[model samples]
Target: MANFISNAFMIPNDLIDKGYMKKMKGSALPCYVLIVRNTRGWNKTTDSMSISQFVEQTGYNKDTVLKGLNTLEELGVIAKKSSKNRASEYTLTDSIIAVDFLDSEKLDSEILDSENGSGSEKLDSKMGSGVENLDKLLSKNSTHNNNIKTNTKTKGNFSEEFEIFWNAYPTCKRKSDKSGTFKTFEKYTRVISLEKLIAILNAFKMDSQWIKNDGEYIPAPSAWLNKKHWENDFWLKAAGLVEQQPQSAETPEYANPQRRHIPTMPKRFKGMNA
Candidate 1:
């Protein structure tokens, strides 16, 4: 007989077969595996990791680790239980294992046997009433399923609104942080409606400043949304309501006022009688 390490953990085949692994990209898989490994004998709902620990164990940069965690959370593979400073407590969700796994035939048989006196009384004692225990388990699973459905609907709504924001943004540069950008949009929309935000984006998209030099000065979508840059007066200059300082040779007075010496009438024209 072989003895297994108490800290060893298992990944379910159903997670991969059901495409849950595919949804977690890059370092997310390794990071999740590390978390699962740490929580092996403990209840799945109490796993935790600090940002420094994740970086040390995964050898991924802080941002990459954070993004991986966010991806897992978004996919419903994990739930963030709490956070303080740079550390966060996380837990594996039921999505990682199939509902059927919880109701395995072996467990059912044991449960059934426990109902009769022929089986170990210890099993029945530990489980209390086997049938009643099964009912509670099923009830908890039902609630988990309902919560997953609600989260899916919320994520869908966020994706739809983010698509609108992405299309209306003035520049396509730095569009990779869609998740982070969407979070900022979600926060802002609580104070201002999505329609208003889109209207403002539309107005700024046509601003001369944003269009100037092929949008060389336009902020990235994430920066623009996070900083609420649309509220700045620069957009007014874009709409041509506010005058921008002239930069052409024809406007030397405004462009370089100190350099413009008062023109003494050319010496040749000084003596001419008009």
Candidate 2:
């Protein structure tokens, strides 16, 4: 059987030529292209895709798909939001916007050059104008580069802090919700410090109840942050402090045989007593 192509998708030349595609490895480009194709238009920055869909569309294994997504995310090419019961939603980051800006600048410069080349006399007259345009382009490019640097720095700081919290947390389940957890952390920054949060997480991580059954009772990171469970007394209870009741004196000896002490009969009466 032969398959016919009924639809075509557009990919930006700059995405490849500008070194973005080269920076990615394995299936990242294919996955990114599929996402861009499924999006409504060039300006649309977000698209939803599940792992299964990526595997089916790109003919890539699940691990490859995951690696591609992780690379894209780490490179700041995309941001993801995941939830307990929903597929991850991905949004193209500012890198795409920068590419668009550069492309437009290049187009404008080409146009200006073409117009000036129509006549030598015109070119001579517009040489100063061309120089001014060139200067402006350089200035704009410099500003764009600065903005990228700032964004990268901010992302790096966030990842560092989030990594600390992730490592301190007891459970590894629902780790895909890290983006959501980071958002929560940002929201609560004024209410609590990251150091304090990490300390509290460490306390919970050592808690008998939290670590019981291999952290089966520990909440997901997103859930813990969302519920502000760090402020709760679960850690104290797990430490065997709170929620523990004292044994009553009236408690039956049979109920706690370890605490029971029975008197021994005298040796002389041992055999004579019934």
Worst ten-residue run, lDDT, model 2?
Answer: 140-149
> Per-prediction count of colliding residue pairs?
0, 0
Q: Go through the candidates in order and give each one's C-alpha lDDT.
A: 0.62, 0.61
lDDT by residue for model 1 (114-203), tens: 678555665545444544554455454342221233555453334434554665565455566666777777777767555556555656
TM-score of each: 0.36, 0.34
- Candidate 2 — what's its lDDT? 0.61
Candidate 1: C-alpha RMSD after superposition: 18.0
> Relative to the unseen true structure, what is the C-alpha lDDT of residue 26 in candidate 2, on a scale of 0 to 100?
97
Model 1 C-alpha lDDT versus the unseen true structure: 0.62
